[model samples]
Target: MAQNKNALIRYKTIDKCLQNRYRKWTLENLIEACSEALYEYEGRDVNVSKRSIQLDIQMMRSDKLGYNAPIVVYGKKYYRYDDESYSITNIPLTQNDMDILSETVQMLKQFKDFSLFSELIGIIQRLEDKVYTEKNHRDSIIHLDKNEDLKGLEHLDVLYQAILKKLCLRIHYQSFKAKSPSYITLHPYILKEFNNRWFVVGRKKQKRTNTHLGIGQNFKHSVEP
Candidate 1:
């Protein structure tokens, strides 16, 4: 099934909120939590409706999305997961989930334009590897060039989003030629992969530099916008 990105975010936020058994979560609390989470991740304030969060909780309680979360109401107003160990992240993929993932991987592979899909290539490959491992019960057959110990990969998703949203980012980076790490404000434009390595192409936010920097995917990097 095709997923709604915002809905997924709301579900995750609700799940996280409910996981904190120490806090007594009400409907208003959940709505606030979801709104705050969306603002933090997307860098914008989104008005999360009560009905939307209600539906999110309903869906999480059902088997439709394979969550079947053990969410229960207590004291007639507060919500919490009955099973403390229950978490959506911990749920194993069902056979149907694997089938859908396999189809998605196959469909994505048909697109040959790597430039447009550079950042997604790693994520798709990881999904492909998981599907392959589950099916064959062994290691992946189709090996892609990836460094298991590669640093700064965690910044990929946030940077990609920032580029799409045209958000300026404050980055701390260290180049091999530099004596120490330097800090710069950047307007990220593209994520490029070449020669089995990834790079983020962007211009300096403060100075109008004609020559934009290509930040290589490596050690010691931080992004904040």
Candidate 2:
């Protein structure tokens, strides 16, 4: 039963199933309850078998899941886990989930040349393990990019800090079409990139008024600074 792909559940599912069961559970009934709950939670079908349920019962009984899960024979049937509340963290992952996470970790390691992202592979490995083991799949599909290399790194960092602090900046910027450099005071609001080049989006100080600059703003008024 452990080798079957269709019969595995994490520890949290087991805890929720037992909590939802108001009365005692026979082996057959418990298996049914677990399968149904798993289907509702994960939108996946799980086939519950007697042998599989027996092994689950044994694992629960070993105090491995923080429950003194006991087997009781009433009218010649096996029942287990009489406790009211159990933690989901006590659940273990199926071997398949572990293998999939290991493969993903290997892929993340291929980009170790990026210094800022060096530890990201290990972080993801730990996160995958924690999710599968605890059955905490609430925000499971989330991902992030850790790459940090970019041109004008220090200037970009200063712009970001100014935006976060709601401060204005006076910049000396050299424009390709201009004969000389330009000085501009800008209230930083947003930053964007296009064609591998960075751009600043904000309100620029104009000849008698303040004008907002963005992707669609007039090019003549959008001086680089």
Candidate 3:
């Protein structure tokens, strides 16, 4: 559901490996396996290499994917989840991977200040957990852009929920020129980002004004509807 490149590759590897029990695959085999799987799923062949698989393993170990299964090697044979209290498949994630993922989770905490929808966060977390890795790969990894405004995430989320539900909202809008916060009821129809700032396009209920909120409204007025 989430269109993360690293996460998708990891998931495909794990799924492909799990689908075949008697089959033992090296990194090379896993790459081919994933290539075939992608061809079947995407209706096109996507080129894959050992480096990509290695990165997938790194990402999974980074714990962003939340899987911790040990693929064991016996002489020439390779198998995952041989014997443990939790099957390798059931391991959830390796400690290292969990640490990385935990850091990711922590980074997301910057949005905790804003209004958020429970369902949206749940969906994001679920998708985040599906990432995995293969034999030759190091682990799965994801790096959020650091120079981005993480705080605006909550505002985006609130706007998204309002738009999805078609619900009007009472928002405390701050205008830089006004020097004070003003309350307005808005029929939030869309959320847009321009120049890295988010805007809520809606109709103001009080003034019955059709407004496009982009660079921040300086003058404050109330919306009735």
Candidate 4:
């Protein structure tokens, strides 16, 4: 079945709720949990009905989606996973899924000649290597950019979430010329990377913002705001 983004989110929420063996999850509780999770992730209130949760549980329990979650009801009301280690995320990709991904990689390889796609070439190669490794049961042959050792790399997810939620952020930043770091309020617009270094492009939250500054000039300041 082709599931919408919201439906997939609800399924994941239900899976997480049922995975918590310490909590006795009822139908009402599951609905409330799913509603809260959707609100937090999507930044909006979404009504999660009893029927929706029931359908999600039914789908997870079936082989239709390959989840086949061992969801069981105890005390005739509370729901829990029969196997504690069972998780929808832990499900491996099927052979058909691998075939589709391999084809996609091949298609993406055709765009490597374009200048716009230069940055993504490394990412595409990494994805191709990952698929090859999973399918062949061996290590990856291609070595791409590994940013695991890069400084301030951990903040990517939080910055991404802030941008998605349309939320302002207080950033503590330091420049090489600056003696110390300063905190500034920023309305994050986009996250960009150039020359293997990550930077956030956004307007500073200030009354007299320096909008006339060029992109290269703006990066020199200790705190724009």
Candidate 5:
């Protein structure tokens, strides 16, 4: 794992170097950048080998990792991408990847009848739908549920992630009875849907009682701690 991480860091550094059209990139420059990057991440001076970087460039320039980066050398000394806009991180999804995502999402959705998995189905559906839309360049085909007038649906993904990651959130919300919105630090626990409406259940900071709030006009939030 350590070796893999270091190689990943070196590859990123090399890609960054090739992306800078303003600078004349050399092999030594890339090696130095990789060494610096690893040192910053590892908190120690790491010795980046010339051979390793050479192999990394070779690997990036090949189709083995699906990058097939257009690394070119002009003046026989400087290296840059032939296509300046290409990067390994932005590779388009392949057919196999799409198949795997479809299968996995469908499998998970099959268990949504169980209470433990009900609230998260919407989140997973959005993820799959997003991937599909990006891949197909059209609207999502797998429509799960339609609640067009639903409030706070835009914040569902972040709230769900916060609950799963055990993080706190500071949300600004105005209830039906309140005259103005107020901020509260929340430790999100569960998301529940009833009657086509969503509620977030959690405990507020410095409070013992658990509270459930209707998803309202909560447009801004921050982590409590």
Candidate 6:
């Protein structure tokens, strides 16, 4: 895993260790806890360095990450939170944090149609709601420089949804080369884009028809099916 990603895990691990008031956590104990936590995530042993943990503690104690954790070393040996109720999880989002998360949510919305991002829809929605209240007063952080007049882009989402639902599409399309448009009832398996152009790759609905079709949606249809 990346170092930046691992740092988050270590921070959480250290926070958890300090939260357990029953355990007198030493430096070594904190390091071991972080390593074990990483092992569970990475499925391989991650040697958590003492310096890294020290830096993590320092970062948490600082306002840089918006986590001014009350970490204090007691008895000149063991570590604990100065405040009993303090945990990094309880830290409120700073304005800067909200801005970054707001920008991220907007960026993620553009790719929400992909299967990989399907599970993130709920998370994205929640993040959007969170950042919108703060961001509503200001201009959006991200804006697509897309040409709204692009052909077939409007139908892209409808076809993409059909692909996910395993539903067939009956579309009337007229390619640029042909004088008149043609219609095809297809089982659209995928929608691919190349060179700023979109194509639907699917097979004919008629059985024993070995010919498959790769068509674009630029063609106009006579009827809505």
User: In model 5, how large is the Cα lDDT of residue 51?
Assistant: 96
Model 5 Cα lDDT, one tens digit per residue, 29-65: 9999999999999999999888998899999999988
Candidate 5 has its poorest 10 consecutive residues by lDDT at 139-148
In the range 1-225, model 4's lDDT, one tens digit per residue, is 323888998888888887788889999999999899889878988888888998989989999999999999999999999999988977877888888888987898688677756455545545665676687786434322454323343454455456556677766666666787666677766555554455666677874452211122223322222
In order, the Cα lDDT scores of the candidates are: 0.73, 0.53, 0.55, 0.69, 0.80, 0.70
Query: Candidate 2: where is the Cα deviation over 4 Å?
Result: 1-4, 10-13, 21-24, 34-47, 63-83, 91-225
Give the alpha carbon lDDT tens digit for every residue of 1-225 in model 2: 543333346344555555654566567677777788668766878676778777776776676654445444566774534444444444456567667776775677577668755346336534554544345443322122332322343344355446656677766666555676666777766555444344566666554444333222112222233
Specify the poorest-scoring 10-residue window by lDDT in model 2: 214-223
Error of 5 at 169 (Å): 23
Q: Compared with the true structure, what per-residue lDDT tens digits does model 1 show for residues 1-225? A: 223877898898888888888889999999998888888877988888989988898899999988999889999999999999899977766698899999998898676366656556567756866776676676433333454433345565566557656787777777777788777777776665545555677778666663234445533344564
Tell me the lDDT of model 1 at 108.
Answer: 86
lDDT of 6 by residue, 1-225 (tens): 588889999999999999999999999999999999999989999988889889999999999888999999989989999999999876656688898997897898788678867556545644654565454553322222332233354455466556555676677767666788677777766555444455666666775443333335554322225
What value does the lDDT take at residue 183 in candidate 4?
64
Give the deviation of candidate 3 from the true structure as CA RMSD. 14.0
* Ranked candidates (lDDT, high to low): 5, 1, 6, 4, 3, 2
Choose the strongest candidate by TM-score.
Answer: 5
Q: For candidate 3, lDDT tens digit of each residue in 1-225?
A: 623653485565655584466776677777777787677767887887778776765554455555544445555645343443433254545557666765765566556555664324433433243332222243322122232332344455456555655677777777555667777778876555555454667888766667766424342332335
TM-score head-to-head 1 vs 3, winner: 1
Candidate 1 residue-wise lDDT at 130 = 70
- After the best TM-score superposition of candidate 1, give how far the Cα of residue 63 lies from its true spot, in angstroms: 2.4
Point out where model 4 deviates above 4 Å: 1-3, 118-126, 136-225
- The alpha-carbon lDDT assigned to residue 187 of candidate 3 equals 87
Clashing residue pairs in candidate 5, if any? none
> lDDT (0-100) at residue 24 of candidate 4?
93
- Collision pairs in model 6: 173-219, 174-219
In candidate 2, list every pair of residues with a backbone clash.
Answer: 11-91
Report the Cα lDDT for candidate 3: 0.55
